[model samples]
Target: MRVGRELTIGTLSRRSGVNIETIRYYERIGLLPAPPRSQGGHRLYSGEHLERLVFIRRGRELGFTLDEIRDLLGLMVGKHTCGEVQTMALAHLDDIRAKIADLRRMERMLAATIARCQGGGRSECPILDALAGG
Candidate 1:
């Protein structure tokens, strides 16, 4: 869809599901380039802004850090081959696998703690005890 004319930060936020403050934060962190402002100093966003914001949000949803998203954006700006993108994706997949492994370990630990709870009262909750390193 053609996002015509200039869009205010609020409009961009609504359209992209990214918070207005987050857009500013991304600009501050260089993840998103600062856009031109209006005569009254209001930020003016265009279709490109919407597209890039969607890309950033999608990357974040896929478990990429801001730094990694920045790198991916940079790579996207160049004429990279499919092989290069595939390699980067494979690396990200490995990272996702590692995170899944860690989460599984945490789940197992939590399950064991829950199993240990005597279920008599809140004061004796094993989950709380485990969190307290007991």
Candidate 2:
């Protein structure tokens, strides 16, 4: 959080805990604005860049897709977007719930299949049978 003055790309990467390649890729994908260059052509990043990168990293960690992140960023210009943001968040939460349900189902199936396994040097495997759609 020592994000005061202009920083090099390396400094930004270290400060934000995001890789340099990811920073460049974010710039390429329009998630991040291109930073200005120094006299010698080295990219000079402002504190705002560091903040934005942190936001992006957190969004990614929270399972927000890049396009959804872009939407969030676009909505940051005004307070009127709170309702919209909430709607998007709810949709994402629903998707997460559905995925959790699927994962629980998978866990149950796997556990049941494993329980059926005797595993006494048997040539037949319940695991293989389940995998083979049996």
Candidate 3:
């Protein structure tokens, strides 16, 4: 559908790949504006809702927290400069890089533990010994 056209909540959920409850939660958190309700009290979402929901879902998949997504959405609405959005994205990138570094450290620790236990019996298992605080 075209932007600005009305759609049912189900349609929006399907199109956006976001759950119906999540859509409601976004509305409650002010990340998304509450759409107009139909005569039957059902939510009638418009194209703008679809666009915003897509943005939210994509941001979530990229590891952004709801608060970060909110800031990005605010920037979009306010027509802020691209530099501001880039700054937020760069911060998120740094966070992801740090997590990768932590995971690499964990991998090294696990590998060392495995190496220490290779061909060892249960009584000599350094992995379990380490876990047991030995």
Q: Considering every candidate listed, which one attains the maximal lDDT?
A: 2
lDDT string for model 2 (70-118, tens) is 9898888656567899999999999889999999999998999999999
Predictions in order: lDDT: 0.89, 0.93, 0.90
> Which residue pairs clash within candidate 2?
none
Which model scores highest in TM-score?
Answer: 2
Clashing pairs in 3: none
Ten residues in a row with the worst lDDT in model 2?
74-83
The CA-based lDDT of model 2 is what?
A: 0.93
- Cα shift from native, residue 40, model 1 (Å): 0.9
Q: Lowest-lDDT window of 10 residues in candidate 3?
A: 116-125
Instruction: Select the stronger candidate by TM-score from 2 and 3.
Output: 2
Candidate 1 is scored at a TM of: 0.88
Task: Output the worst ten-in-a-row residue range by lDDT, candidate 1.
Answer: 120-129
Indicate the residue-level lDDT of 15 in model 3: 95
Q: Where in model 2 is the C-alpha error above 4 Å?
A: none
- Model 3 CA lDDT for position 13: 93
TM-score of each: 0.88, 0.91, 0.87
Candidate 3, residues 8-125: lDDT per residue as tens digits? 9899999999999999999998888998898889898989899899999999999999999989988987979999999999999999999999999999988988888867355577
Tell me how far the alpha carbon of residue 90 in candidate 1 is from the true structure, in angstroms, after superposition.
1.1
